[model samples]
Target: MSVTDRPVPSHDRIARAAFPRRRVLQAGLAAAAGAAVLQTTAPAEAAMRREGWIRSRIARMSVEQQVGQLFVMRVYGNDATASDNRNMNEYGVASPAEIVAKYHLGGVIYFAWADNLPTPAAGARLSNGLQRAALAAPGKVAVPLTISTDQETGIVARMPDPATVFPGAMALGAGRDPELTHDTYEITGAELRAVGVNNDYAPLGDVNVNPANPVIGVRSFSADPALVAELLVAGVNGLQSQQVSATAKHFPGHGDTDVDSHTGFPVIHHTREEWETIDAPPFRAAVEAGIDAIMTAHINVPALDPSGDPATLSKPIITDILRGELGFTGVVVTDSLGMAGVREKYGDAEVAIRAVEAGVDQLLNTPAADVQYNAVLDAVRSGRISRRRLDESLVRILGMKYDRGLHRDPFVDESAVDEIVGNATHKARAQEIADQTITLLRDDADLVPLPAGEVLVTGYGDTTTVNLAASLSDHGHPAQAFVTGSSPSQTLINSAVTRSAAAAVTVVLTYGADTNTAQQQLVQALRDAGRKVVVVAVRNPYDIAGLGDTPTYLATYSWLSVSTEALAKVLAGEIPAAGRLPVSIPSQADPDTELFGFGAGMDN
Candidate 1:
């Protein structure tokens, strides 16, 4: 059945069906006791008792406290050590303790530089310290802060060494197994939770149609909208099943644009029809699958709002398109307001005020927290921003915190941190997923599973060449390594060819060679030197177009160590290449012709 045609059961019915009879009876008994109290208690006490805990907490919050609940501040520090706190002045940002005490911040987001501690124990301590600070802050109602990070596995991971570095979104799509995708995210969720993180900004929903897209390259799952939607839903289920809130990001789609929103505004000129077919489906699927948050993109879509306001500040895009039309009632969050796409045009105060008015539930990662907090307070007090609207966002933000069980216990077990993060089972699963995602695009010469012989491996430095060479050696295939950086000179290419002259086969690894003429020249020189060349794209699969009709070609979609090991095993015939191309590969002969369509993989 189509997604739209699926039946959506009523909430009451679902609740009744999901709860056991004994649990239902317990609820009934509580309701009866509450009714008895209603009859005996004073009117105000009865009202407080009748209202839900979340609403009751909101009723008592001061205006400043209520406004503070909407902001998720960015903090900087390598760990929660006292020395790190003393060094906060270096970054010119307030310490976590001061920010929580002054602003009553709703959430905290960690970046690579801030949270990349040497061990999982340090990370857990940092998270615990942040939670303690938030709860102790002077406020009418002390709510636990939502701690989050970009733990999106591949290139965007914040915790690398201590966390299981799984293959990225494109690899998940190439594997074509939603169950594996779900399991991969489940393991990620567990690790994040182990360190006291309750939210993960992951599972990119953008359909990567443009190969040259700078930001959302391999971050996206597939170019096909339906495929992206399916994998996005699976990823959401995986995350939420582990009690971590998963975010579907850069919404209203940031896939087709060439400009990175980090530095400049990207404009998507698609009409409404095109958006419905290409961009809107994955978001719609996410909402239907019960995604906890939908992050607004900074890109401007002319069709959605002709005023040219980026979606982060455009009411038409966030309120009308996402909330009204798409029916995403979950928390609406803004991408980092500090990005040049939004920050360049508006001041911090104006950005915060306009984003709330635009229906954003959470204002994320603004450098100037004081300016934003005071601006929002002023707007609400002056009646420029409605109290009702403020309350609406507060409820959603607090609801997520409550659902995450933060109210009961906000701290993680620091002792268990080492036991959970990067465990043996999760690491093995990471390798399994990487093995499943290695695609063999071209093997016309049947050079793969090359008989045990001397092999020459040339690639981008130690991470790619050294690991691949060791894996080949593990499989009884002795291999030599040639480490060439992105821009390889002709002399290096000559050295590679001469070294491979006596070898049985030459394996060349590329990182986005499709756009680099120097790398293409190196590959062409290898082919011309009568070497049996097998080009493996370690990063971008589009590099296949650069090497014209190479006898054997493969794509690993990532340069992670596990991915490198998987590729080596595939080359040594220990495992078959099972992954298909998630995106199309343009032909070298005709730039307009696609040499390999989506889901194209060769096992033999």
Candidate 2:
């Protein structure tokens, strides 16, 4: 039966029922699982084989079909027939394939919590199945989907086992080698392509000027806009060169806010003049480099738009500022619509309508796909969202798919996934990049090449500490690890102090120790006990500012396994520390005073 003639399903009817704004907008997401495999893809071919394929396709599309093209929904399950509670809760569908068919979806996003990335073969099967369903859906245009994910590498990497795990944007920024940045992302793009994902929401272009930023900290390349701009372009080139569409995200910048937009709205107080110099540079660079897509931040900037609407719903920010001022003609996509930053100001349906009116080309991860789809469909039929507007977004969205070669072939060989992702070459290159990001901030005690004696590795995540211990041991340094959980309690700290009594040297690996007194106490306690204390800020470098007289400290800019291994090598004198601080370290005692300025690092 044709898609239009098919009887409305019960779930669709339920989704269409009237409900309170909060109920419709409420969304839940589980944390992603850790570790996975990887894959590789060929260099991009010429843009869609047929010059006018998108135009021809759009001409034949019905309003309903055209509306579908503007959304990239989230679904649960690793394969077409797979179903789970998360799928039913989020999409009201039985399986991932059913969501694609029922919604006539433009594309679907993969998330680990949704069971969308259990294994490389599983991911390939899901991608291939979704593409088939998209073409087979009755009355729907046979356009392939732009399968996407947040494979930002480092802390945000989603591809599991065997996928090469490289350092994050900040780490690469610390290395300050654009060529290395390009090589890293090229490997990233190849792996994503091998898993059948066509788009990656990565290579953040935000300049993190605020050290107190609760979100975009290590995710950003650097606090220097020029540096961020330089690395962003190389990253974009690398990903697109591998045929995976690269997205420069959180436009107008999300790097200066103390609040995370995922849970709260953040306002950038930067005056227009300051924004021009600080926040606008990277985005300008992205446009010049021909980035494929730009993701909008759900942030409010009064200097640009006095309307109080966040960038996602403000025409002044999106249309006037981005499209007109910056001249970015590429696809403009909204951050997840379910985020509190976007939804707190409007209802679910209104959020979608306003985003489109704001000149956004796509709506990503809406609270409920059916509701937002119907809302946009109704608005289009009523002439509220102009036909010209709808056509503009359709052309851009479809063009992305075509240019990325999704239209030509969206299926990946499941069996071949194991051979491409996390292969020997990718792993070795990732390690090399990781080694380049280790920065030795201080070694006043001259204990860096570490004394020849037993060592105790403690602090932060249990897995991370254990891994560091193993990596150190692998480098011929005898070590034992002590777990101090994410937020180490006084008991845990006291226990660690007692445990370190027998060690010749105590290595405290901190996460966010600048804010956790227990972590600082653990470091101080070991020193008070007359044991040599070496503090390694595995996540953020600001930790040292809180520990007043730390004699030896290092910064890895991330806590990924590869980064930890690199730290082990540096600590064991197996490699020299070569990284510099990507962002400045602020003084905890006096926020006005500088703790350590940017570009502060010393070689071992």
Candidate 3:
């Protein structure tokens, strides 16, 4: 689907289109009605105009309280340790529940640690804990609390024990499968909503314009801007279908840089015309499709704002372009206040104040609550920014809270969260995607089937690959799987070379893009041992730049254990290799070159 496939229609038209797609029967205010509501509802009294006592009971607040509705800072649970405290201090708060209660804060984004006892039933329990805390203190009126989470596939996921993972967005785009994209994201959203996650900052619409981009490499849908726009729209629509709010993020683009925007500032140099042409397409498509939110990029776009600050602080980009030109009247959010792109340069208090000045509806991952809150209060008192602007942002945030039905009721079914999270269906669907997206980019020697002799398998030490090895016992071969990572005094490549001599074909597998040293060691080991190394380029192909003399090679651009097992079957000749490279896997020394284009592969 091209950008022109659907002209940027009005929000009413988009809502009409989206209503049929949604299972909910909720009627929303039209633009005119919303504008009228904004005009008639006073800053201190919008909560009282026409709402019922139950909704008005807790949903309305003063202008100051309304502005407070726009900041969704990161939070930690009660069991946080020293490291957790340090991490939170960098950008989040120590006790989020208390902050929400006192400040009447809008929402909390959970960046829960890897081993924080994730369970399907935990989502609601955690949400209820936060909600109860947030509602402890009544506002001048009353307002509900909002909770959100980042459950992107394979990265920062929070699926409970029984849950499975689908291929990330890039794999779906690489496979050129829209049905798969729609189905996978829909399942993901269902799983999230079942457990009480209302907002999902996903379907990374940013095109992977830069292959070396540290953050967005495999998270993006495709390198082609057009395809990213198309598949991303489908992905967002799929998520929205499940009643979960889908958000397009890293606005103005994040896929064209090698540096990590989280730790450093990277600049995009697209011209104004190019912005209209390239970077803005995905976001514009989402808004036209009635997407709930758009998250600002931390990276600087020189053309959008020459001030060198990220788009999060630039009015020309956020207000003038995003709000004015693009006609996105929905919530506009910042990525995270603590990200180095903005934080290393701006003050905590100033970050919150400037973001609002830029017309943002939500301040993500706030730095210091005390500093940020005081700065906003100072800005309001000093007349630097208006009560109207604050109220304007707050109204949208309140609308979202109302839409979430928090205003009508400020509680989650804490007891119900466990039943819905990480259940059988969720895991099965994740496994299905894991199996489906597992591709076969290379199989040059057709030396699969293992010949029933010595077999060698290896990949990341993480949970996925370890599970693959455990599952591979069914293949009827003597298999040895090694862990891949940067090790002390020893490397994965060195270990692979040493072990390759004893195996028939070193069926090497790797997950995640950063595990390169292990892959290199495997290639070198294969060459030195004179073994048939049927290499599998999992995840980002950018990792395996040099594979020495390995005649047999495969690309299964994923690390899911199910996919890894499927690849093992392909190697064992149980199934024909039907997958191909969604992205090019370049050779060694030619780190700048691509061996094959997207969709390049061999099959039966």
Candidate 4:
């Protein structure tokens, strides 16, 4: 039967069915309690049953197996044990399946380059194979593996062609409807669940305060703490409602830094009060909403933790702030261990031990799974990491597996992959989201209903521009696309200008023109040539500050196909531009002044 043949049941019903109490326990409850007590107390009893089951499972696990449960490792393979895949052979195993069994792994993460997601069916097959290996591991270590991936929709999606390509967080923020955010994530969770991925590392909780932020630009929902918090709660509720665990990531915020943590260490000097007001609200909201997991950021905040350790390895940050102050009882997982943000301060073994010591429940994507496994094992044996500490994380990890229904059935029907992934309903919703996120900031020349003639679409990338042209042509607009590289050479600019002279209207897409003088030059040159130009900021809306005087200007927070296609329909007069800016566009001369304030949008 098709996975979407009927309406999806609520998460409460699904969880109850997946982790039902024993028949004896059910009978005992019926016999011991009056109907009124059972009616009011069933939820409490259910929680006790889940905790009891998790404890029983953990009690059976050996020390080696318990240590393994702390790490969520990654391997390179589509099949169980392909000889061609050798990225993880350091574990004395050739295939991912072999490694899962050899280490008695608690979970595995999928990455595109790891050859783990060629197709939806292949993903299901790989997940099933991994689950089988984990379940059949030796000596009381058999449990289902919690399969996961960074399917955060916009910029970080791993699944190809058939998966619904929804816009990124900034786009959704522009749409500015909490219920829309919820529905979009529900579709995202449904697709991931259909393919057997039980966990999603998504719904960023960062408040992007710095306009110069390098990494968390379009990934953030908005710059306002209250807005980000509102969307985050909706996203968490939406995703978990579909039975796939939702992870609110980069706790303590990665927003104000100009440096990319993946490459360098970033230090945020937000005072305790500033941190509490600007960055901590969304995470507090996620915890209040019962988020399944919270991923730690690798950035350092001196005001919060004077120890100078990154949040991923800082007891004060992870344990004191997140667990104690915020009262988060869910799993606390680290960002990838291989990123330079975490690695620059410590070695591999030290990183693993410190993360566990700092109260991180799961270590993600360690450089070498075997090294981390051995280090953690030795730490536990030597009491550097207490037995209580090891079991504490183990219980959270195991409990999440049971709650997400991974332990009940960790496999997906491969046959249903084609039916559910990128289906018509999901695609239409994606397009609708894209439509709502197209913010038309200005149209002074009133060239929106493009003057009737051939349209010239030129942009920084060939794929991006060509796709926009294709989408335009599909919208019955006669359009031709030209590629102007990020740093467009004078030659490419001259060619695009000459082509623009023959067209009635020219639509130019800018990517990071704010700092790229070459791109800024290209936009000015077109305006200097007296061509009818409409500028669209596709990557960063800050691009608008550079070309602010253009007669017609727009911002689509993402350059993904869904977003560009929505831009095409709007340009073709098929749909109206209805999105508001989620972040303010600061004036170039004075960063404190807004060239285009937040919530700026003009309809055609």
* lDDT against the true structure, each candidate: 0.82, 0.85, 0.66, 0.85
Off by over 4 Å in 3: 1-60, 78-96, 114-117, 408-410, 462-465, 487-495, 511-518, 548-550, 573-580, 584-593
> Per-residue CA lDDT of candidate 2, range 247-302, in tens?
99999899899999999999999999999988998888788777889999999999
Predicted candidate 1 versus true structure: per-residue lDDT over 1-604, tens digit per residue: 0011112223333233323355323457789788767656877774464337678778888898888888887666645434455235533344666666577778888776764355677778888888888777664477788888888877788875768988899988888777778988999999989888889998899999988888998899988887788788878888888888999998899989989999999999889999999899888888877889989899999998998788999999999989999898889889998898887668889999999999999999876776888999999999999999998998888788776778789899999988899999999989999999999888887798775579888867676798888888888889888887788988887788788887888888898898888788878888888878888888778987877777789888898888988888898888988888888877767768998887788884
Model 4 lDDT tens row, 188-266: 9999888888999989999987878999988999987877887887888888988888899898899999999999989
Global CA lDDT computed for model 4: 0.85
TM-score of 1: 0.90
For this target, which candidate reaches the highest TM-score against the unseen true structure? 4
TM-score of structure candidate 4: 0.93
For candidate 4, the per-residue lDDT at 475 reads: 85
| TM-score per candidate | 0.90, 0.91, 0.83, 0.93
TM-score of 2: 0.91
**lDDT (0-100) at residue 207 of candidate 2?**
91
Prediction 2 global C-alpha lDDT: 0.85
Model 3 quality (TM-score): 0.83
Across residues 157-189, which tens digit of lDDT does each residue of candidate 3 receive?
666565556667766764565667777778878
Poorest stretch of ten by lDDT in candidate 3: 1-10
Clashing pairs in 4: none
